[model samples]
Structure formats: C-alpha cells, structure tokens
Target: MTLPHVHIIGTGLLGTSLGLALRRAEYPVTLSDQSPTAVRLAADMGAGTAAEPSTADIVVVATPPDVAARTIVAALDTWPEATVTDVASVKTAVLAEARTLTGDPVLARYIGCHPMAGREKSGAIAARDDLFLARPWVVCSDEDTPADRLAAVVALAEATGAAVVHLDPEFHDSAVARVSHAPQVLASLMAGRLKDMPADGVALAGQGLRDVTRIAASDPGLWTQILAGNAAEVRAVLADVRADLDALIGALDLEPGALATIAGLFAAGNEGHDRIPGKHGQAPARYSSVTVFIDDTPGALARLFTDVGELGVNVEDIRIDHATGIKLGSVDISVIPSAQVTLTEGLAARGWWVPEAAIDTEGRE
Candidate 1:
C-alpha cells in the first residue's frame, strides 16, 4: 500500500515545520516553493519529497497572507485528491477570497487552519519539527465543510502534537486580533519608541520591555500583509486600547488620591491575566529558585530531580542551559517559596554545586 503523501506549499517556517513533523511521523512528504533555494533547503532538512504537490493526500498552503487565499484556491482547484488547509494568520479574508475564487464546488474539501505557534524567526532554516508541539491549532469550518476534511486537518495537527480547536472563521479572526495581532502592533509601536534613545538606553532594558515588545522583531514585510488583510479587526482592537490609554492618561491627571480610583483598573488587569493559561494549560504558578551545576551526562537531569524530591520539595519549574557538545550544564530548579532553602542545602550537600538559591527576582522565570 502507498503511504499517504502530504504536500506543503511555500516552504517557510510554518510550512517546513509542518512538513518536518509529518515526515518524522512516517507520512510521505512533498515540499514546494517559488524559491528554489527554499524548496531545496527544506527538502534537505528532511521536511519533504521535493516534488510537485499534485500527488499528495494533504496540501497545506503556508504562504503569507497576500497569497494564502489564492494559494488555497489553487490547491483546491488543482488537487482535488488532497484535503486542503492553510496556515495563514488571518482566516476570514482568506476564507472569503477562497469562497469567491472557488465558488461552492470545492469548499467542502478545503478547511481553514491556523497554528497559534511561532518564534521570532523565519524561513525553512528556522523551522523546527517540534515548533507546533502543545500549541493550539485552530480549524475553522463553515456549514458546508466536509467532516473528512476537518478530520484530516485535525489529524495532521494532532500528529504535530498540537491541540485542536474548532471555531467559526469570523470569531477566530476577532479573537486572534485581540490576543495576537494587537500584541504584535503594540509591541512594534513600543519598540519603535526606542529608536531615538541612546544605544545604551536599551542596554538598561529589562525583561518587561522584552516581554512586551519581543514580537516587534517579526518580519515587517509579512506583518504589513497580515495587518492589511485583517485591518478591520486589528483596528478595532487598537481602537479599544486607544480608548483605555486615553482614560488611563486622564486618570493620571486627577488630583491627589484620584490615582487610587484607577488602581481597580490595574487590579482587574492583574486578575484577568492570571486567568489565562500558563505553560501547558496550567494555572499561573510562581516558584522559588535553586541553581545547581549538572554533570554533562545522561540522566543528569533525572538525578537532580530525584535529589530535589528527596528533600520533599516539588519543582514548580526548571530550566537547563546545556550547550551543544559541552560537558557542563547549568540547571535552575524552581520550587515552592518555602522549600528553596531546604532544597538548596540538600542538593549542595549531595555534591551538587548550588549558586544562587534566591528567586531570580526578574524575567518571566
């Protein structure tokens, strides 16, 4: 029996990553791009077949917003044997364009998709097979969409270790406008303010600024297309933010204890922030730190955790910086606040070096 072939169009980060994931799972893969270099590189990186997409069972259009709709339309029109999907950020416009381009004939064979995962990186070279792991991959289907198409897309997403979410295309755009696009614009705007400041000014920058503006480093060419495609929804969110900023400025001007009134606004923000899921859908949990030196050997991490468990301390978080081909590892374990001292001493006495046991006191850590 022939293995199912999955074709990925536009072998950029998302496309190549998906291809890498599908290929790793033993599915047959084919990769294509207008750039021969991109196609060659992604294929060399074990992403796909490096052949035309006409013979695949799945076709994923992962191009930029400008061409994503037409790309999807072309896939549906050209590859009726394949279940069609896209990884474009803005779904509403692409879906609308696909509707106009293909009419009702191929709608059921096409599913609108967006994987809510990315890094401040681009191109096939930056693609990682596990990039979509544990991230939300949304599938939007209209009433006319076929169950098999939706299931195929969901299966692809699940094979990449992503959780599948279903939503209407319109709501998906609006929701992302609030959580994704608005943040991108806001980050760009904030980072833009740093241009005139002294170079040393950024040297003094803390993780807070980095956290808020990290997405500012995204590709401007790609973002221009996305913001343009989802202009209405993005503008709506920005408008609401503008109104809040104006109110906040007005509140600052109030005399004396007038500042106290706006405290509720901030407190509300804090509460709402806590309600959002943390890493792996867990609630927001804070941790105290215990820094340890790890031997660069197999099961070193396992031993560290075992030692920590012996101290009756639960590790709430952990980070490891083990450079490739290096013989030493720096591991920071985050435990309950009250257990930091006990765990630190226990690990140190067990011949593990403990440096800073205090909470990092900064950064998202």
Candidate 2:
C-alpha cells in the first residue's frame, strides 16, 4: 500500500520542520505557503514538494494563531477527506473561529494542536528536521473528532519523535500562558530595557544575562499576535507573578532576619525547581571533569577529540572557555567517571594537552 500524502499549510519554522521530519521518514508530503519564496526554500530544505492542497490525506495548518482558523476551515472545506490539524499556539479563539466557518457537523475533521517546540528564530531557514524530537505536542481532541483522524495526527507527532499530550483547549492555553508566554514576555521586556545602555555596559553582560534573555531575539511581529490573541490568560498568569514580586519587594526593607518570610518563599521555589524531570526521563547524569589546554586554532578541538576517541573513553559532556587575545583556550571534558591518572597519562602521550589540575565536578562522579 502507498503512504498517505501529508499537506502542510505555511512553510514557516514549525511547518517546514514538521515537513522535513515527515519527508525524512519517507512519507509523501506537500507544502503550501502564501510566500512562494518560503515554499521554495522549504522545498530546497527537503520539507516537501510545493503542491496543491486538494491532494492530501492529512492537512496540517501550521500558520500563526491569527490566520490558523481561517486556513484550517478553508482546507477542510476544500479537502473533505483530509484529516485537519493545526499547529497554532493559541487554541480557544482558533477553535471557535474554525467552528464558525464550518456549519455542518460532518466537517468535523478539525483537531486543534500546539507543539511545544520552537526557537528564538523563525522562517524556513531555521527549520530543523529534529526540531520536534522529544518535544511535547498538545493535541486538543473533542468528542466530535473522528477516531481515525486522531490516530493519524498522533502518528504524525510520533513520526517526529514527539510525546503526544491530550489537553482541553482552555486548560492548554492557561498552562502555556503561565510557563511559556509569561517567560517570553519577561525576557523580551527585560532585554528591551537595555536598549539605551552604553555599549561597554552591555558588553559587560555575562553568561547569566545571555541565558536569561536569549529568547528575547524571537520575532516580535509574530509574538505580538500570539500575546494579543491569548492576552486574557497571559495577564491572568502575570498577575500572580506580579503579586509575588510585590511581596518580595515589601520584604526587602525589613531588618536583618526580618526578611525570613521572603527567604521562605524562595525555599518553596527551590523545591519546585527540584521537581522538574531530569534528562531523558531518568535521574540526572553526573559528570567528572578533565580539563585540557587548547591552542587558539580552528579544528584544534576536533583533533583533540580524534585523539580522545583513540583512548576509548567517552566524554559525556564538554565546555570550551576562550580567553581574549590569548594563544591558548581551556576545554573541559566531562566524563562519566573521574579522570584517572592512567587516562590522563594516555591522553598526554598522544600529544593531547592535559592541564596540571582538573576542575571539580561538584562531587558528581
């Protein structure tokens, strides 16, 4: 039997990412976008062929929330047999608009979905085949949804190696508003405040500032639409955060241990932080450090890895810290077990640079 053809509307990041994943899996795929250039770029990126929408077995509307409903409704109207799903961020408004577009209950092919995977970038240029890998994809299925259609959409998620999660539209919006939307707003707002800062002041930013505000580079035009569409839920979540901040501020003027109450609040936050799942749904892996001095040259680390591969000891993780205008850089290789003297000697014999002392791994292995 032949594989079903999947049609994707909008060849932006999410759409093109999904298309590339599906196409890589050898699934027949069709891509459409309002921008012919984007569609062509997606095609070149191995997403799929630029084809008409009527020839698909599944139609995924991967447009922004503002346009998803109309596109989904039109696709369903135009392709009756196709199972329709959307990758919109906001669900409630889109679902309501979609229902309004289709009067008959038979046109029940629409299933609202939001994939919790994206980056600080946009467009087909940033589309990666593995973008959805190990990500949570929320599928909002109502009672009217067809069994086969639900399965097909879930299969699409599985095809991209994503975890499928079922959620009610309202609950989905509220949850995302708390975790995702709020963070985006905070990051962007914080970064915006630094606009007038001196170049030297901004240049003094360290990794902490980079980590916190990395997401601020996201497309403002797209995010403005998303934040506006789900303003109610976003504001609701932000209100609680505002209240917490207000309380913390009030505690600041208190004498010495008079701020114990504020510290207690942070203790609660620490517990919440610990509750988050570790990597790969398992306990977090511990690391032991092996620091090496690298010369400031391209492919130096690659040559070091080639030598390390000869030793047959796997490096679990690695970090490189380069010194400004210095001839040498430090690369810290993290292994599962502590780097033994024998391992160090073997690496040094192969002309690899081993530091006199290794960095501590916080008692981890």
Candidate 3:
C-alpha cells in the first residue's frame, strides 16, 4: 500500500512523535507549528521536514485541547483532499465545535482521535517515535463522517503501532475524564500534600509514594488547558472522588460502622486495581518475586540478567532495595508462577544465596 503523505500541525510531543512515527513507516511527513522554533527542532530531530504547499493525504492536528477544534477546521480547509484527525484528549467539545464550524461535506472528512500515550515531560525534545507503540488510540466518529476518512484515521494509528478503539465523542470524553483527568488531579493533589512537609518526612519517601506522585510533575499549563476544556466530564468524576474522600475522612472519626466503611473502600480499591490489564493488555497475571543479595558494584545487575537469560527465565519486573550502610543490596526479580522453582533452583546452584521463602508467591508486595 502507498503510505499517506501526512501533514502534522503543532510541534509539541504528540505531533512530533506522530511525524517521526509516520516517517519511520516510510510515509512522507511534513510538520508545522505556530512556534517556528518548535517546528525547526522537530524537523532537526528527523520528525519531518518543514511544511510546504503540497496535497497531504492525511492531516493530523495535534494541538492542545483549547485550540484543537480550530486547528482541525483549518487543516480541513487547507487540505480539502485529505482526511483530518486531531489528537486532542477532550473530544466532545472539539467535535461539537467542528460540527458548528463546517458544513456536512467538510465535517465528513474529519475524525476526532485521542492517542492514549504520553510522558510527564512535554515539547518536541521529549518526543519519541515509538510513543504510540501498543498504546490505545481512541477514534471518535459520527454518522456524517465518511468511511474512508475513518479508515485513514485508523490507518494512521495502526501505522504508528497503536491499538485502535472506536468510540462516540461523548463516551470518549467521559471515559478519559474517569481514567486520565481524574488520575492527574489525584496525583497532583497527593503530591501537593508533600510541599510543606519537613525534609526528614520527605526523605522517607518510598516506591509507593514515588509511583503516586510521578505524573504530578507533568506540565501544569497543559493540564490546566485539558481540565478546563473537559470541565463538565472531569468535574463529574472529581465530584465522585470527593465523595469517596469524604467517606474516608468520616471513617477516620471512629463513628459507628465507620471501620466497616473504611474496609469496604479499601476492598473496592483492590478490586479496581486488579481489573487493570497487565502487560500488553492481557489479564493480570500473578508473578512471584525472588529476592537475592547482590553487591552494589557495577555489572552486578548485568551478571544477574545474563544468568537469568541463560536459564531461559523471563523476568517480568525487578526492584532493588539498597541496604543502608552496606555495600550489598537486595534484588527482587518477579517472574511468572511457573518459573519460580526453576529460577530459585538455578540461582542457588550458581552459588547465589537464595534465601528460604524468598519467593513472594502472593501478588505484588
């Protein structure tokens, strides 16, 4: 198949990454941005060349939520022959705006899309060609949207190695409000509590706290725009979360049945957490961890990995716990339940200290 000539506007992370991914797939890609420096940087990074007057087969508007509708309309106007799509997180507002801005003919060529992939960092510099690999790319379409235009949008997502999912614009907006927007708000809120803490209290931070606050470091300006654009849906999700928060607070007051409410809340959290798919969209598999003591010297991890590779044991995940005031650390290697015995025996035979009962057969600790 002859790949589409893709024209990407907005040289931020998603735009630049899309350009690079399309270019890597042997498609002709052209990039443009309101910021000349951004376009230049993305072009220099091999994302794509500077935009020129040419017929684009597909026009991708990767602008922020606030400007997505306008950019999509402008792209459709400029490239009348091309199928247009936007990578805006919020879709309902943009789709509604596009419906009002253009007649049925022009609107038929446009599809609203949101690629569920990103980093805490922003800008063209942080863009990666493989950003969309194995990620969910939601495509919002309507009755007025043409079949070929929808196919073109799906092709763009699939060409970049994303898994495409079809959704209505309203559902797309509501779904992201629950999954993406709510998480960002919660992460930021949790991180904010640490702002006034003592240094010692902050120093005690562990992996759990780090995991919770990681997305909190994202660009506030971008999030502010997203939250504002999806205010209605996001507010709905936040209201529910606030109610849960109130319940938890009330539980802490030790009123009658409060303890049971707290327990129910925790149980609900576990159930929800377990529902999240494991690696590669598969059912969550339980992995067993095998902890081994290793020196803190260089090549220690490499040696362990090499040994495991030789044993044909695939490590699912790993964590290192540095021993305080010591040169040795504990390495916890998580593997599928079936590999637990083989890995434990092999490491012990290789003269590695495998502590008895070191395998955490129960789910993640």
Candidate 4:
C-alpha cells in the first residue's frame, strides 16, 4: 500500500511528534512552521523534512486553537484533494469558524481532531514520537464529511499509535471542558496560591503539591489561547466548581449543617475519583501502596525498579516524594493486593527499608 504523505503545519510539540511518528511508520512527512528555526529544529530531530510538500495527501493543522481555523481553511485551499485535520484541543469553535470561513465543499475536506496527549512542556524540544501511544485521538466528524477524508484522517491518527474516538464537535468540546480544560484551570489557580508564600513555606511542599501543580509550569500564552477559545464550556464547568467552593467556604464558617456539608463534599469527591478508569481505559481497580525510603542519589530509582522486576511483582503505579528536611526520597510503589506482600517481603530481604505498615503481618493489611 502507498502510504499517504502527511504535511504538518506548525512545528510545535504535536506537529513534530506526529511527523516523527508518521516518518517512523514509513509515511512520507513534510513539516513547516511560521518560525524557520522551529521547523529546522523539528527537521534536525528527524521528525520530517523542513519543507512543504508540493502534493500533500494529508495536511495536519497542529496550530493553537485560536489560529487553527484559519490554518485549516488555508490548508483546504492549498491542497484541494488533501484531507485536512487540526489537533486543536478545542473542536467546536475551530470547526465552527472554519465552516464560516469556507464553503461546505472545501470544509468537508477538513476534519477537527484533538489528540488527548501532551506534556506540560511545549515545542519540538519536548516532542516524542510515542507521545500519542495509548492516548485517545478524538475525531470530530459530521455526516457531511467525506468518507475517504475521514478514513485518511483516522489512518493518520492511528499511525501515531493513538486510539481513535469519534465524537461530534460540540460533545468533544463539552467533554474536554470537564475532563481536561477545567482541570488545567484548577491546577493553575491552586499553584498560583503558592506565589505569595514564603520560601520556607513553599519548601515544605510534598508529593501532593507537586502532583497538583506539575502542569502549572506550562506556557501561559499557549494556555491562554486554549482557555479563551473554549470560554463558554470551560466557564460552565468552573461555575459548577465555584458553587462547590462556595459551599466549602460556608462550611468553614461553622454554619449550621456545616459538618454534614463538608463530609458530603469529600465523600462525593471520593466517589467521583473512584469512577475514573484504570490503565488502558479499563474499570478502576483498587491497589495497595508500599512506601520505601531511598537515598537521594542517581540509580536509586533504577535499582528499586530492578529489585521489583527481579521479584517478579507487577507494579501498578509509582510516586516519588522528596523528604523536606533530609536528603532522602520516599517512593510509593502501588501494586495489586496479591503482589504487595511479595514485593514488600522481597525488598525487605534485599536490605531495603520497608515501613512497618507495608510489611506483611498476620493481624492486618
């Protein structure tokens, strides 16, 4: 089969990653960006040739949400027969604007897509070919879209090792508002609270703080475009969050029924968290956590993983928490209940520190 040549516009993270993945998949890829240096960097990283394809079979608009519609329209006009798709996180607004800019015939050649994969970091420097692996690549196609065009876009998405999900533009926007967009807003807000804190106060942070604020270091200009583009849906989700925040504040004021309200909120949060899918989009499964203290040095993590691997225990998850006052890191290894005992015992026998609670005991878990 002749692999379709994919011409990617915008040599940022997504575009470069897609180019790398397509090139790895034996699909001819051409890359371009407004910044010459950016496209050159992507090309240097073996993503694609730093040039435009004369005849593109597929044109990917991997620009920001604000400019994505214009880019999509331009791609449709540039390559009349090429299937054009955008990887903008927001779908509805981009699709709406693209439809407004061009006629139905040209617009039918364009499809709005969102690859539910990205790191907090941006740019080609952070691009990874395997970034889309195991991530959901949402395709917002309508009845009016051509079958061949849809297939081409889907094939492009699959080439990046992403699982394709078909969703309408409106639903994709609302769904992302709840899952991704709102969470980013919340993380930024919570991280901002630390800006005014004293050095000592900030130094006392733990793993929980790190987890919440990890993405807070993202590029403000890029996120501004995303949040602005999906204002309505994001605002709706934030308004609901605001109501919950108001309730929490009221409870903190020691009003009547305050305890019940506080308890209900936490309980509801737990229930909601429990509903989240497990790895590979499977149903949630409970796991036991085993905490191990290690010296803050290189090879410590690798040694721990090697130990676990030697024990033949399957680890479900891992979290590292640096000790505040000491040069030590606490590693929390989560595994199924069945493997918890085996892992803990194996580590303990290997002279690794095992917390009393994590160790196998006849009386308790």
Instruction: State which candidate has the highest TM-score.
Output: 3
Report the lDDT tens digits of candidate 3 across residue range 129-170: 999999999998878887877887898899999999999988
Spell out the clash pairs found in candidate 2.
Answer: none
Cα displacement (angstroms), candidate 3, residue 281, comes to 0.7
Tens digits of lDDT, candidate 1, 26-99:
88888889999999999999998788844668888998878998888888878877888899989899888888
Candidate 3 — which residues are off by over 4 angstroms? 358-362
For residues 51-143, write the lDDT of model 2, one tens digit per residue: 885568999999877988889888987888888889999998888777777774745788889998998788999999999999999999988
Candidate number with the higher TM-score (2 or 3) = 3
Q: Which has the greatest lDDT?
A: 3
Q: Which tens-of-lDDT digit does each residue in 1-365 have in candidate 4? A: 89988899999999999989999999988999999999999999999998877789889998877899999999888888899888999988887788789899888788889999998788999999999998999998889888988998899899889999999989988998998888888999999999999998998787678888888888888889888989999999999999999999989988789999999999998788877777748777677788899999999989989999999998887878787678999888878778888888899999999896343332111
Q: CA lDDT, every prediction? A: 0.84, 0.84, 0.88, 0.88
Clashes of each: 0, 0, 0, 0
Error of 4 at 245 (Å): 1.2
Clashing pairs in 1: none
Instruction: Output the lDDT of residue 338, model 3.
Output: 86
lDDT score of residue 298 within candidate 3: 100
TM-score of each: 0.81, 0.82, 0.94, 0.91
Error of 4 at 198 (Å): 2.5
In candidate 4, list every pair of residues with a backbone clash. none
Which pairs in model 3 have colliding backbones?
none
